[model samples]
Target: MHSVIETPMYLRAAKAAGMNDAEMKAVVDHLSMAPDDGALMEGTGGARKLRAAGRGKGKSGGYRIVTYYCGKDVPVFLLDIYSKGDKTNLTKAERSTLREILAEVANAWRESARRKAQELRRNDHD
Candidate 1:
């Protein structure tokens, strides 16, 4: 299973939307098991929109979660979230910001992997 990392923005949105620990856990567990569970959002540079069940509401009435998962080397990122009633789609600025964020995340993860591989090789030669 891939790791799920929740951003501060998502945490605050989840809290404001009345999502409790259990609900958040369920969302994370689902994403870890199936990181590609959602549909790819256009113009967000690989961001996805996942519809998760909230409290007593079903998926349709639940919450919308924005996430990014490049591959195994990178953890699934919970970028932002909101109740269905709060918003239906992200603004153009939000999409642009997400694209920039995704690029940075990918770059950082790649660097970390490179460093780890270097460490492993150094250890093997010891």
Candidate 2:
């Protein structure tokens, strides 16, 4: 299973959307099994949106989870969440913000992996 990282924004949003621990766990579990299940959201710089069913609420009236998955090496990041009643789509400004955030997240993950690899190589030589 791919690891799942919940960003602060997502946590806050989930709480505001009234997602219980069980519901949250289910969402994480689903994403861990299928990290690429969500549809790619254009203009969000690789962000994908997954519809999560809430308690008694089918997907039609469920929550939207914004996520970013770099690859197998990197964990899937839950960027944001919102109830369907909150809003239908992201605003232009929100998309622009998400684009920048996604880029930075990808870059930082790559850099972290590179540093870890370098450290491992150095340790091997010792």
Candidate 3:
């Protein structure tokens, strides 16, 4: 199973957002540990429902949480931290960036499995 990972930047940002380290840790911790919440994860591959509030706006009136799900087996939904004042609600640029990031994460796991599959193939050939 994949392990949960967090960044120093996110730690500080979460704190600034009023979420303490413990709270942040708790969120990242249950990422895979907890059952599927409202949505599975649109980024993985499936239907989605963006937060009706449109994630609101930040100091510059352009920042908010973008919630979505990818697919069924995703296990957990992806939460994107960005701004809504950019273009449109859940616009292409936003989706593109989110897709790239999600793809990177998924690609890592796929790469590991691919290596294992190749090893099995070599063994069979031998």
Candidate 4:
């Protein structure tokens, strides 16, 4: 079985964002076991997005998945869990939330990558 590494930082961020344990666990399971396809889990927001990239999940359980690239080969990091709005229009609040979530995830991914790199370097030097 493949092992997924969700550093404690991820859990902390999820908690900071008000994600209950169950919800965070669900996303982690889905992300870890997901096929290695480069499927795009596009963002919500609207038709005129400037820096937006994740969409909100609708009633069907499909939500926006923002991914942060770790390296040239590492699997993209799953950002956050977002619930969709009522219609085609994305409220200002929703967009702001989406950006905030993605930023947080990106920061985490970068940090993870740095740590992993440092470990590898230390191992190689030894």
Regions of model 4 farther than 4 Å from truth: 1-18, 35-62, 68-72, 86-126
For all candidates in order, the CA lDDT equals 0.91, 0.92, 0.45, 0.46
Clash count, predicted structure 1: 0
Q: Residue 58 deviation, candidate 4, in Å?
A: 8.3
For candidate 1, the TM-score is: 0.89
Whole-structure CA lDDT of model 1: 0.91
Q: Write the per-residue lDDT of candidate 1 for residues 32-116, one digit (tens) a residue.
A: 9998879999998999999998878899999999999898878899988998988999999999988888878988988998999
TM-score of each: 0.89, 0.91, 0.43, 0.38
List the pairs of residues colliding in candidate 1. none
Please report the TM-score between candidate 3 and the true structure.
0.43
lDDT of 3 by residue, 1-126 (tens): 324434454444444555445645545555545323334334433323322222234234533433333333333433544334443345556556766766655455557878989999999999
- The clash tally of candidate 3 reads 11
Highest TM-score: which candidate?
Answer: 2
Q: Which ten residues in a row have the lowest lDDT in candidate 1?
A: 101-110
- Native-to-model Cα distance after best TM-score fit, residue 16 in candidate 4, in Å: 8.5
Candidate 4: worst-modelled 10 consecutive residues by lDDT: 45-54
* Cα deviation of 70, candidate 3, in Å: 7.4
Could you tell me how far off, in angstroms, the CA of residue 105 lies in candidate 2 after the best superposition? 1.3
